[model samples]
Target: MHALVVDSDAAESSFLSAELQRHGFDAQECVTGAEALEIHDKFDLLLLDLRLPDIDGLEVCRAVRATSDIPLIAFAAGDHGLDRVLCLQAGADDCLAKPYGLRELIARIEAVLRRSGPARTAPRPATDPLARGSLCIDPLTREVRLNGRLVHLTRKEFDLLHRLAADPHTVHSRARLMTDLWGYPAGYVPDARASRTIDTHVSALRAKLGAPDWVLTVRGVGFRFGRA
Candidate 1:
Protein backbone atom coordinates (compact mmCIF):
# COMPACT_ATOMS: atom_id res chain seq x y z
CA MET A 1 0.00 0.00 0.00
CA HIS A 2 1.09 3.58 -0.70
CA ALA A 3 0.43 6.61 1.50
CA LEU A 4 0.65 10.28 0.56
CA VAL A 5 1.57 12.51 3.53
CA VAL A 6 0.89 16.20 2.94
CA ASP A 7 2.37 18.54 5.51
CA SER A 8 4.09 21.91 5.33
CA ASP A 9 6.62 21.04 8.03
CA ALA A 10 9.52 19.20 6.47
CA ALA A 11 10.54 17.39 9.65
CA GLU A 12 7.00 16.42 10.56
CA SER A 13 6.11 15.25 7.08
CA SER A 14 9.27 13.20 6.69
CA PHE A 15 8.86 11.76 10.16
CA LEU A 16 5.31 10.61 9.55
CA SER A 17 6.18 9.30 6.11
CA ALA A 18 9.13 7.29 7.39
CA GLU A 19 6.99 5.96 10.21
CA LEU A 20 4.35 4.87 7.72
CA GLN A 21 7.01 3.16 5.63
CA ARG A 22 8.09 1.25 8.72
CA HIS A 23 4.53 0.03 9.03
CA GLY A 24 4.60 -1.60 5.59
CA PHE A 25 3.41 1.34 3.50
CA ASP A 26 5.36 3.01 0.71
CA ALA A 27 4.89 6.55 2.00
CA GLN A 28 5.59 9.67 -0.06
CA GLU A 29 5.76 13.27 1.13
CA CYS A 30 4.03 16.30 -0.39
CA VAL A 31 4.54 19.69 1.25
CA THR A 32 1.84 21.69 -0.52
CA GLY A 33 -1.88 21.40 -1.13
CA ALA A 34 -1.42 21.87 -4.89
CA GLU A 35 1.08 19.03 -5.08
CA ALA A 36 -1.17 16.85 -3.00
CA LEU A 37 -4.19 17.65 -5.14
CA GLU A 38 -2.24 16.95 -8.31
CA ILE A 39 -0.59 13.59 -7.40
CA HIS A 40 -2.98 12.26 -4.76
CA ASP A 41 -4.76 9.90 -7.13
CA LYS A 42 -1.65 7.78 -7.33
CA PHE A 43 -1.84 6.82 -3.65
CA ASP A 44 -4.05 4.41 -1.75
CA LEU A 45 -4.58 6.86 1.10
CA LEU A 46 -3.83 10.47 2.05
CA LEU A 47 -2.67 11.92 5.36
CA LEU A 48 -3.56 15.56 4.89
CA ASP A 49 -2.40 18.36 7.13
CA LEU A 50 -5.09 21.01 7.54
CA ARG A 51 -2.58 23.86 7.48
CA LEU A 52 -0.97 24.20 4.07
CA PRO A 53 1.20 27.00 2.68
CA ASP A 54 -0.45 27.09 -0.76
CA ILE A 55 -4.22 26.48 -0.62
CA ASP A 56 -6.54 25.85 2.26
CA GLY A 57 -6.82 22.24 3.33
CA LEU A 58 -10.62 22.32 3.31
CA GLU A 59 -10.63 23.38 -0.32
CA VAL A 60 -8.25 20.59 -1.11
CA CYS A 61 -10.56 18.17 0.61
CA ARG A 62 -13.48 19.43 -1.48
CA ALA A 63 -11.47 19.19 -4.69
CA VAL A 64 -10.39 15.65 -3.98
CA ARG A 65 -13.84 14.62 -2.88
CA ALA A 66 -15.36 16.04 -6.06
CA THR A 67 -13.33 13.66 -8.19
CA SER A 68 -12.17 10.70 -6.10
CA ASP A 69 -13.06 8.69 -3.01
CA ILE A 70 -9.57 7.90 -1.78
CA PRO A 71 -9.42 7.48 1.99
CA LEU A 72 -8.27 10.68 3.71
CA ILE A 73 -7.16 11.27 7.27
CA ALA A 74 -7.03 14.90 8.22
CA PHE A 75 -4.41 16.18 10.65
CA ALA A 76 -5.10 19.16 12.83
CA ALA A 77 -2.47 21.27 14.59
CA GLY A 78 -4.18 20.76 17.89
CA ASP A 79 -7.41 19.44 19.33
CA HIS A 80 -9.44 21.68 17.06
CA GLY A 81 -12.97 20.35 17.31
CA LEU A 82 -14.36 22.48 14.50
CA ASP A 83 -11.57 21.59 12.15
CA ARG A 84 -12.15 17.89 12.73
CA VAL A 85 -15.88 18.28 12.11
CA LEU A 86 -15.26 20.31 8.97
CA CYS A 87 -12.84 17.71 7.73
CA LEU A 88 -15.38 14.94 8.18
CA GLN A 89 -18.01 17.06 6.51
CA ALA A 90 -15.65 17.81 3.64
CA GLY A 91 -15.19 14.06 2.90
CA ALA A 92 -12.43 13.02 5.24
CA ASP A 93 -12.84 9.49 6.53
CA ASP A 94 -11.30 10.42 9.86
CA CYS A 95 -9.50 13.27 11.62
CA LEU A 96 -6.52 13.09 13.95
CA ALA A 97 -4.64 15.59 16.04
CA LYS A 98 -0.90 16.10 15.86
CA PRO A 99 1.52 14.40 18.34
CA TYR A 100 -0.50 11.25 17.74
CA GLY A 101 0.89 7.87 18.65
CA LEU A 102 1.82 5.44 15.91
CA ARG A 103 -0.59 2.83 17.19
CA GLU A 104 -3.47 5.27 17.02
CA LEU A 105 -2.51 6.39 13.56
CA ILE A 106 -2.26 2.78 12.36
CA ALA A 107 -5.57 1.93 14.00
CA ARG A 108 -7.28 4.89 12.35
CA ILE A 109 -5.71 4.03 9.03
CA GLU A 110 -6.84 0.42 9.23
CA ALA A 111 -10.34 1.43 10.31
CA VAL A 112 -10.64 3.88 7.42
CA LEU A 113 -9.32 1.29 5.00
CA ARG A 114 -11.80 -1.26 6.27
CA ARG A 115 -14.69 1.12 5.67
CA SER A 116 -13.37 1.93 2.18
CA GLY A 117 -13.17 -1.75 1.25
CA PRO A 118 -11.45 -3.33 -1.85
CA ALA A 119 -7.97 -2.40 -0.60
CA ARG A 120 -8.35 -4.06 2.77
CA THR A 121 -5.00 -5.79 2.41
CA ALA A 122 -1.66 -4.67 1.08
CA PRO A 123 -0.52 -6.06 -2.28
CA ARG A 124 1.87 -8.97 -2.38
CA PRO A 125 5.38 -8.78 -3.78
CA ALA A 126 6.27 -9.94 -7.27
CA THR A 127 7.29 -13.57 -7.60
CA ASP A 128 9.82 -13.18 -10.40
CA PRO A 129 13.43 -12.44 -9.52
CA LEU A 130 14.55 -8.87 -10.22
CA ALA A 131 17.34 -9.01 -12.79
CA ARG A 132 19.60 -6.05 -13.53
CA GLY A 133 22.39 -6.76 -15.94
CA SER A 134 24.23 -9.87 -14.68
CA LEU A 135 22.87 -9.35 -11.13
CA CYS A 136 19.71 -11.13 -10.03
CA ILE A 137 17.77 -10.79 -6.79
CA ASP A 138 15.30 -13.34 -5.47
CA PRO A 139 13.25 -12.06 -2.57
CA LEU A 140 11.56 -15.34 -1.78
CA THR A 141 14.83 -17.22 -1.50
CA ARG A 142 16.65 -14.18 -0.15
CA GLU A 143 19.43 -14.83 -2.59
CA VAL A 144 21.53 -12.83 -4.98
CA ARG A 145 23.23 -14.32 -8.03
CA LEU A 146 25.83 -12.55 -10.08
CA ASN A 147 26.86 -13.84 -13.50
CA GLY A 148 25.22 -17.23 -12.83
CA ARG A 149 26.99 -17.74 -9.47
CA LEU A 150 25.60 -17.03 -6.03
CA VAL A 151 27.18 -14.05 -4.27
CA HIS A 152 27.40 -14.11 -0.50
CA LEU A 153 25.79 -11.12 1.18
CA THR A 154 25.01 -10.31 4.77
CA ARG A 155 21.37 -10.00 5.75
CA LYS A 156 21.56 -6.22 6.00
CA GLU A 157 23.53 -5.93 2.77
CA PHE A 158 21.04 -8.05 0.86
CA ASP A 159 18.14 -6.05 2.28
CA LEU A 160 19.76 -2.72 1.44
CA LEU A 161 20.62 -3.85 -2.07
CA HIS A 162 17.18 -5.28 -2.78
CA ARG A 163 15.53 -2.13 -1.42
CA LEU A 164 17.49 0.12 -3.79
CA ALA A 165 17.07 -2.31 -6.69
CA ALA A 166 13.34 -2.57 -6.11
CA ASP A 167 12.96 0.87 -7.66
CA PRO A 168 15.88 1.40 -9.94
CA HIS A 169 17.25 4.97 -9.98
CA THR A 170 14.95 6.18 -7.22
CA VAL A 171 16.98 7.99 -4.54
CA HIS A 172 16.41 6.72 -1.02
CA SER A 173 17.47 9.34 1.50
CA ARG A 174 20.16 8.48 4.08
CA ALA A 175 17.69 8.89 6.90
CA ARG A 176 15.27 6.56 5.20
CA LEU A 177 18.02 4.07 4.44
CA MET A 178 19.15 4.09 8.07
CA THR A 179 15.59 3.66 9.26
CA ASP A 180 15.06 0.74 6.93
CA LEU A 181 18.49 -0.84 7.40
CA TRP A 182 18.31 -0.61 11.15
CA GLY A 183 15.15 -0.29 13.30
CA TYR A 184 15.37 3.45 13.92
CA PRO A 185 11.98 4.83 14.78
CA ALA A 186 10.47 8.00 13.34
CA GLY A 187 12.02 11.35 14.33
CA TYR A 188 15.23 9.66 15.42
CA VAL A 189 17.95 11.47 13.54
CA PRO A 190 21.02 9.30 13.21
CA ASP A 191 24.44 10.41 14.47
CA ALA A 192 27.29 10.93 12.03
CA ARG A 193 28.79 7.52 12.80
CA ALA A 194 25.44 5.77 12.74
CA SER A 195 24.62 7.39 9.38
CA ARG A 196 27.84 5.89 8.03
CA THR A 197 26.34 2.42 8.60
CA ILE A 198 24.81 2.43 5.13
CA ASP A 199 28.06 3.56 3.56
CA THR A 200 29.83 0.62 5.08
CA HIS A 201 27.20 -1.80 3.80
CA VAL A 202 27.38 -0.35 0.32
CA SER A 203 31.15 -0.63 0.36
CA ALA A 204 31.01 -4.27 1.48
CA LEU A 205 28.39 -5.10 -1.15
CA ARG A 206 30.54 -3.59 -3.89
CA ALA A 207 33.58 -5.52 -2.71
CA LYS A 208 31.60 -8.78 -2.60
CA LEU A 209 29.87 -8.36 -5.93
CA GLY A 210 32.86 -6.75 -7.66
CA ALA A 211 30.36 -4.31 -9.15
CA PRO A 212 30.63 -0.84 -7.68
CA ASP A 213 28.37 0.38 -10.46
CA TRP A 214 25.45 -1.60 -9.06
CA VAL A 215 24.73 1.06 -6.45
CA LEU A 216 25.40 4.72 -7.04
CA THR A 217 26.12 7.24 -4.29
CA VAL A 218 23.71 10.21 -4.43
CA ARG A 219 26.11 12.51 -2.49
CA GLY A 220 24.12 14.41 0.11
CA VAL A 221 20.99 12.42 -0.58
CA GLY A 222 21.38 8.63 -0.35
CA PHE A 223 21.95 5.67 -2.65
CA ARG A 224 20.09 4.43 -5.70
CA PHE A 225 20.28 1.29 -7.75
CA GLY A 226 22.33 2.06 -10.83
CA ARG A 227 21.31 0.86 -14.29
CA ALA A 228 24.21 -1.54 -14.37
Candidate 2:
Protein backbone atom coordinates (compact mmCIF):
# COMPACT_ATOMS: atom_id res chain seq x y z
CA MET A 1 0.00 0.00 0.00
CA HIS A 2 1.17 3.55 -0.77
CA ALA A 3 0.83 6.08 2.07
CA LEU A 4 1.32 9.87 2.06
CA VAL A 5 2.13 11.52 5.41
CA VAL A 6 1.49 15.28 5.62
CA ASP A 7 2.48 17.28 8.72
CA SER A 8 4.00 20.68 9.51
CA ASP A 9 6.47 18.97 11.86
CA ALA A 10 9.21 17.53 9.62
CA ALA A 11 10.42 15.07 12.29
CA GLU A 12 6.93 13.83 12.96
CA SER A 13 6.23 13.15 9.29
CA SER A 14 9.61 11.49 8.84
CA PHE A 15 9.08 9.20 11.83
CA LEU A 16 5.55 8.21 10.83
CA SER A 17 6.51 7.72 7.19
CA ALA A 18 9.51 5.59 8.13
CA GLU A 19 7.43 3.43 10.50
CA LEU A 20 4.79 2.89 7.81
CA GLN A 21 7.57 1.86 5.40
CA ARG A 22 8.88 -0.60 7.97
CA HIS A 23 5.41 -2.16 8.06
CA GLY A 24 5.36 -2.86 4.27
CA PHE A 25 4.04 0.46 2.97
CA ASP A 26 5.50 2.55 0.13
CA ALA A 27 5.45 5.80 2.10
CA GLN A 28 6.01 9.46 1.06
CA GLU A 29 6.47 12.54 3.28
CA CYS A 30 5.23 16.15 2.74
CA VAL A 31 5.30 19.24 5.01
CA THR A 32 2.46 21.51 3.80
CA GLY A 33 -1.19 21.18 2.73
CA ALA A 34 -0.32 22.46 -0.78
CA GLU A 35 2.20 19.64 -1.26
CA ALA A 36 -0.39 17.12 -0.06
CA LEU A 37 -3.06 18.52 -2.41
CA GLU A 38 -0.74 18.57 -5.40
CA ILE A 39 0.34 14.92 -5.19
CA HIS A 40 -2.23 13.15 -2.96
CA ASP A 41 -4.02 11.50 -5.88
CA LYS A 42 -1.00 9.35 -6.67
CA PHE A 43 -1.12 7.70 -3.21
CA ASP A 44 -3.63 5.08 -2.06
CA LEU A 45 -3.75 6.17 1.60
CA LEU A 46 -3.27 9.55 3.35
CA LEU A 47 -2.09 10.35 6.89
CA LEU A 48 -2.98 14.04 7.30
CA ASP A 49 -2.35 16.45 10.17
CA LEU A 50 -5.28 18.74 10.88
CA ARG A 51 -2.95 21.67 11.65
CA LEU A 52 -0.95 23.27 8.81
CA PRO A 53 0.68 26.66 8.24
CA ASP A 54 -0.54 27.29 4.67
CA ILE A 55 -4.05 25.72 4.54
CA ASP A 56 -6.77 24.58 6.92
CA GLY A 57 -6.66 20.80 7.29
CA LEU A 58 -10.46 20.57 6.97
CA GLU A 59 -10.31 22.35 3.57
CA VAL A 60 -7.68 19.86 2.40
CA CYS A 61 -9.90 16.97 3.50
CA ARG A 62 -12.90 18.44 1.59
CA ALA A 63 -10.77 19.13 -1.49
CA VAL A 64 -9.37 15.59 -1.62
CA ARG A 65 -12.78 14.01 -0.95
CA ALA A 66 -14.38 15.91 -3.86
CA THR A 67 -12.14 14.10 -6.36
CA SER A 68 -11.11 10.79 -4.78
CA ASP A 69 -12.19 8.08 -2.33
CA ILE A 70 -8.66 7.50 -1.06
CA PRO A 71 -8.40 6.06 2.45
CA LEU A 72 -7.63 8.93 4.84
CA ILE A 73 -6.62 8.96 8.54
CA ALA A 74 -6.55 12.50 9.90
CA PHE A 75 -4.63 13.41 13.06
CA ALA A 76 -6.82 15.96 14.87
CA ALA A 77 -7.07 17.66 18.25
CA GLY A 78 -8.36 14.69 20.26
CA ASP A 79 -9.65 16.58 23.31
CA HIS A 80 -11.96 18.73 21.19
CA GLY A 81 -15.09 16.74 20.19
CA LEU A 82 -16.01 19.26 17.49
CA ASP A 83 -12.59 18.93 15.87
CA ARG A 84 -12.98 15.16 15.48
CA VAL A 85 -16.56 15.47 14.20
CA LEU A 86 -15.53 18.17 11.69
CA CYS A 87 -12.70 16.00 10.40
CA LEU A 88 -15.15 13.13 9.79
CA GLN A 89 -17.83 15.46 8.30
CA ALA A 90 -15.20 16.99 5.98
CA GLY A 91 -14.68 13.45 4.58
CA ALA A 92 -11.82 11.89 6.49
CA ASP A 93 -12.36 8.12 6.60
CA ASP A 94 -11.19 8.07 10.23
CA CYS A 95 -9.63 10.47 12.73
CA LEU A 96 -7.07 9.85 15.49
CA ALA A 97 -5.96 12.09 18.32
CA LYS A 98 -2.23 12.82 18.61
CA PRO A 99 -0.01 11.13 21.25
CA TYR A 100 -1.41 7.87 19.94
CA GLY A 101 0.39 4.57 19.93
CA LEU A 102 2.16 3.55 16.71
CA ARG A 103 0.76 0.01 16.94
CA GLU A 104 -2.84 1.31 17.14
CA LEU A 105 -2.24 3.75 14.29
CA ILE A 106 -0.89 0.98 12.06
CA ALA A 107 -3.89 -1.22 12.88
CA ARG A 108 -6.29 1.64 12.02
CA ILE A 109 -4.49 2.24 8.70
CA GLU A 110 -4.73 -1.47 7.77
CA ALA A 111 -8.41 -1.57 8.76
CA VAL A 112 -9.23 1.45 6.59
CA LEU A 113 -7.24 0.00 3.68
CA ARG A 114 -9.17 -3.28 3.94
CA ARG A 115 -12.53 -1.43 3.96
CA SER A 116 -11.63 0.73 0.91
CA GLY A 117 -11.19 -2.24 -1.41
CA PRO A 118 -11.05 -2.22 -5.22
CA ALA A 119 -14.83 -2.92 -5.38
CA ARG A 120 -15.55 0.41 -3.69
CA THR A 121 -13.44 2.35 -6.22
CA ALA A 122 -15.01 0.64 -9.22
CA PRO A 123 -18.23 1.92 -10.85
CA ARG A 124 -21.45 0.16 -9.85
CA PRO A 125 -22.54 -2.55 -12.28
CA ALA A 126 -25.81 -1.94 -14.13
CA THR A 127 -28.84 -3.84 -12.84
CA ASP A 128 -31.31 -5.16 -15.41
CA PRO A 129 -35.05 -4.88 -14.73
CA LEU A 130 -36.81 -7.92 -13.24
CA ALA A 131 -39.48 -8.97 -15.74
CA ARG A 132 -42.30 -11.43 -15.08
CA GLY A 133 -44.81 -11.71 -17.94
CA SER A 134 -46.86 -8.48 -17.76
CA LEU A 135 -44.96 -6.98 -14.80
CA CYS A 136 -41.59 -5.25 -14.82
CA ILE A 137 -39.58 -4.12 -11.80
CA ASP A 138 -36.44 -2.00 -12.12
CA PRO A 139 -34.15 -2.35 -9.12
CA LEU A 140 -31.81 0.47 -10.06
CA THR A 141 -34.52 3.08 -10.67
CA ARG A 142 -37.05 1.56 -8.19
CA GLU A 143 -39.88 1.78 -10.74
CA VAL A 144 -42.59 -0.82 -11.27
CA ARG A 145 -44.96 -1.36 -14.18
CA LEU A 146 -47.74 -3.86 -14.75
CA ASN A 147 -49.21 -4.60 -18.18
CA GLY A 148 -47.18 -1.62 -19.61
CA ARG A 149 -48.92 0.78 -17.23
CA LEU A 150 -46.84 2.62 -14.60
CA VAL A 151 -47.97 1.43 -11.15
CA HIS A 152 -47.40 3.96 -8.41
CA LEU A 153 -46.36 2.04 -5.27
CA THR A 154 -45.28 3.38 -1.91
CA ARG A 155 -41.64 2.76 -0.99
CA LYS A 156 -42.46 -0.13 1.38
CA GLU A 157 -44.75 -1.79 -1.14
CA PHE A 158 -42.10 -1.69 -3.85
CA ASP A 159 -39.41 -3.05 -1.51
CA LEU A 160 -41.67 -5.97 -0.61
CA LEU A 161 -42.26 -6.75 -4.28
CA HIS A 162 -38.57 -6.63 -5.21
CA ARG A 163 -37.37 -8.71 -2.25
CA LEU A 164 -39.87 -11.54 -2.79
CA ALA A 165 -39.55 -11.39 -6.59
CA ALA A 166 -35.76 -11.48 -6.47
CA ASP A 167 -36.01 -14.99 -5.04
CA PRO A 168 -39.47 -16.08 -6.19
CA HIS A 169 -38.86 -19.76 -5.54
CA THR A 170 -37.93 -19.19 -1.88
CA VAL A 171 -40.35 -18.37 0.95
CA HIS A 172 -39.40 -15.23 2.95
CA SER A 173 -40.39 -15.44 6.63
CA ARG A 174 -42.36 -12.63 8.29
CA ALA A 175 -39.60 -11.95 10.87
CA ARG A 176 -36.96 -12.01 8.16
CA LEU A 177 -39.01 -9.63 5.98
CA MET A 178 -39.51 -7.23 8.87
CA THR A 179 -35.79 -7.16 9.63
CA ASP A 180 -34.68 -6.82 5.98
CA LEU A 181 -37.28 -4.26 4.76
CA TRP A 182 -38.25 -2.40 7.90
CA GLY A 183 -34.78 -2.04 9.48
CA TYR A 184 -35.82 -4.10 12.51
CA PRO A 185 -32.95 -5.24 14.68
CA ALA A 186 -31.71 -8.78 14.44
CA GLY A 187 -33.20 -11.46 16.74
CA TYR A 188 -36.34 -9.31 16.99
CA VAL A 189 -39.55 -11.34 17.53
CA PRO A 190 -42.31 -9.31 15.90
CA ASP A 191 -45.60 -9.08 17.83
CA ALA A 192 -49.05 -9.42 16.24
CA ARG A 193 -49.29 -5.63 15.63
CA ALA A 194 -45.87 -5.50 13.91
CA SER A 195 -46.79 -8.63 11.91
CA ARG A 196 -50.01 -6.93 10.78
CA THR A 197 -48.04 -4.02 9.29
CA ILE A 198 -46.40 -6.34 6.73
CA ASP A 199 -49.73 -8.01 5.93
CA THR A 200 -51.30 -4.59 5.37
CA HIS A 201 -48.55 -3.58 2.95
CA VAL A 202 -48.69 -6.91 1.09
CA SER A 203 -52.49 -6.54 0.69
CA ALA A 204 -52.00 -3.01 -0.66
CA LEU A 205 -49.24 -4.24 -3.02
CA ARG A 206 -51.45 -7.05 -4.33
CA ALA A 207 -54.28 -4.56 -4.89
CA LYS A 208 -51.96 -2.17 -6.76
CA LEU A 209 -50.74 -5.01 -9.01
CA GLY A 210 -54.37 -6.11 -9.62
CA ALA A 211 -53.47 -9.67 -8.65
CA PRO A 212 -53.47 -11.33 -5.22
CA ASP A 213 -51.16 -14.20 -6.16
CA TRP A 214 -48.17 -11.90 -6.99
CA VAL A 215 -47.40 -12.07 -3.26
CA LEU A 216 -48.69 -15.31 -1.81
CA THR A 217 -48.87 -15.80 1.97
CA VAL A 218 -47.31 -19.20 2.87
CA ARG A 219 -49.89 -19.91 5.60
CA GLY A 220 -48.18 -19.56 9.03
CA VAL A 221 -44.66 -18.54 7.88
CA GLY A 222 -44.65 -15.39 5.64
CA PHE A 223 -44.95 -14.52 1.94
CA ARG A 224 -43.46 -15.46 -1.42
CA PHE A 225 -43.77 -14.28 -5.02
CA GLY A 226 -45.95 -16.44 -7.28
CA ARG A 227 -45.18 -16.45 -11.01
CA ALA A 228 -48.85 -16.90 -11.91
Off by over 4 Å in 2: 118-228
Write the residue-wise lDDT of candidate 1 on 19-117 in tens digits: 898889999998999999999988899999999999999999878865555788998878889988888777677899877888999999988776454
* TM-scores, each model vs. reference: 0.52, 0.54
Error of 2 at 189 (Å): 19
Candidate 2 — worst ten consecutive residues by lDDT sum? Answer: 117-126
* Model 2: lDDT of residue 207: 85
Candidate 2: C-alpha RMSD to true structure equals 12.2
Candidate 2 lDDT by residue in tens digits, 93-160: 78999878999998998777665542233223337898988999997888999988999875567777
lDDT of each: 0.80, 0.82
Candidate RMSDs in order: 17.4, 12.2
Model 1: residue 105 alpha-carbon error in angstroms: 0.5
Model 2's number of clashes is: 0
